[model samples]
Every structure is written in C-alpha cells, then in structure tokens.
Target: MNTLLFCIQNETDAMTALVEVLGQEQTALTQAPSLPLMEEINAVMQRKNQLIASISQLGHTRKNELTRLGFKHPETSMPEWLQDQAQVECWAKLMKLTRKAKELNRVNGLLITKHLIRNQSTLQVLYQNHGSTSTPSLYGANGQSNTQRSTVRGFIAI
Candidate 1:
C-alpha cells in the first residue's frame, strides 16, 4: 500500500518532467532526418511485438512497458513493479514515436508466432494431453485382491 501511494506521488511529480522531455525530443526529431527516427521507431515497435508474443505464447496477455521494450517483468503477479511503465515514460522523453515503435516488433513477433502455431496445428497440439497410460492393476481401490472367478467362458442364456 505504501509503495502504491509512493508511485502515485512520484507520478504526480514526474508528470511535468515527462512533458518537458517530450518537448525536447520533438525538437530533436524535427531537426533530424527520419531514417534514424524511423529506426528507433522500428526498434520500439519490435520490442512491443516481442513482448506481446512472449506473453501470448505463454497463453497470457500480460505486458509491461519494459517488457515491450525488451525488459523483463520483475515479478510473477499483478502490478508488477511498474518498471516497464517507468521505462516507457523515460523513452517517451527520447521520442514520442519510439513509444509507438515499441508496439511494432511485438506485432511482427506475434504474427510470425501465430503463423507457426497455425501451420503446425500447434494450437490444437499445444493443449493436447498425450502420454502412455499405465495398465490397470488387478486390485480394487480398497486394496483387495481382484480374484479371477470364472463360472464359464461363454455366456449362458437364462
């Protein structure tokens, strides 16, 4: 609870810092050719796609800004440290478009993974439970011996 409160306070303080960073980054992008900008955008996008794909392959829909940008999630549960979110805000200062780029690689990665899963019937096979069954023992559930008492091998008409 304290951590959550801290995050809220920190965000309020950082909001102005974020806006200033964006302003500076936009100025830089305006003066620069798009090739490098394009590349950065592409990188962020790739990471986004990768993060999504990773989660999807895990059969889940969880992603953090850090994960989208190739950073690992710090925990196994909800509200995972908010590291990715912070990372995105940081990168946001560098490029508004990079923020968008983070979503691209993720898209590409997922598309590729989806195709592979489809072609191999992997979706059907992924959830398939396959294994050899053990032969049933000649004993009852209560540990009583199951005697092979046979009256006749053939059925008699009553």
Candidate 2:
C-alpha cells in the first residue's frame, strides 16, 4: 500500500512537470520564433521526455502493486481496488492531469500543423517570385498530380 502511494505521488509529480512543459511548448508554438524561445522549447522537450519516462516507470510499479494485491487485470482499473479516500483522490488528480496534458498536446499539434502550412505557403511565394524552374513542385489540393503548373508570368513583390 505504501508502495502504491509512493508510485501515485511520483506519477502525479511527473504529470505536473509534463503539463508545465506542454504549456511552454504551446506558448513557443503560438509566438514568433526567437533564439531564446527555441532554446526554451528544446529544454522543455528534454524535460518532457524525462518526465514521460518517469511516468512510465511509475505506471509499471503501480501495475505490479495492483497485481500483488490480487487484481486479475491491474491495467484495467485501479480505482476499483483503491479503498482509501486519499488514494482515490490522488487517482482523480492524476487522471485530471492526464486529460489536461492530452488536451494541450492536441492543441500544440494543431499549432505546429498551422505553422508548417504557413511556412510552405511562404516558400511557394518566394519560389514563384524568383521565377526558377528549380522551385519545388507541389501537388494539387485535389491530390491528382504534382505536375500542375502555375500560369502567372509576372512577379509581384509584397
């Protein structure tokens, strides 16, 4: 029981760290790119990886504890085994943190996709302006072919 408590507390702490890193990642993705911000993002990524590893270890420990307590499928549900109020509360907190982390991660993924599309558009414009045949070929949105050629002959600098 003590081991279970320790694992729960460690998992909760790791989840908290992951949430902080994910929040920082979102901020970095939304804002303009900068040296310092990029540095911070890299640092956050490393921290996030470490926290994830710790969480996984704690989860394994938790599974073992549950199994030792005669749970046939420890991974299925820990709440059913938990009788202590404090342990149940800790489980609730861990679940909430997990949900928050998932939400933030999803948002960050969308932000990254938006940034990629924006950068690709910018590159396409720049390539067209340069009037170079060596410019990257792009596939049509209809997904038919990449052979579609642009008809615009004049370059307009913005």
Question: lDDT of all the models against the reference?
Answer: 0.43, 0.83
User: Per-residue alpha-carbon lDDT of model 2 for 1-158, expressed as tens digits?
Assistant: 48888888899998998999999899888889789988988888898888888899999999998889788999886868678899899999999999999999999989989988998887776566445668653545786545544444464332
Write candidate 1's Cα lDDT for 34-58 as tens digits.
6786676456445544544543433
TM-score for candidate 2? 0.78
Instruction: Give the distance in Å from residue 25's predicted Cα in candidate 1 to where it truly belongs.
Output: 3.4
Model 1 residue 98 lDDT score: 39
User: Model 1: residues >4 Å from true position, as ranges?
Assistant: 1-5, 13-17, 41-158
Task: Say what the RMSD of model 1 is.
Answer: 21.1
Candidate 1, residue 19: lDDT: 41
> Which candidate gets the maximum lDDT versus the true structure?
2
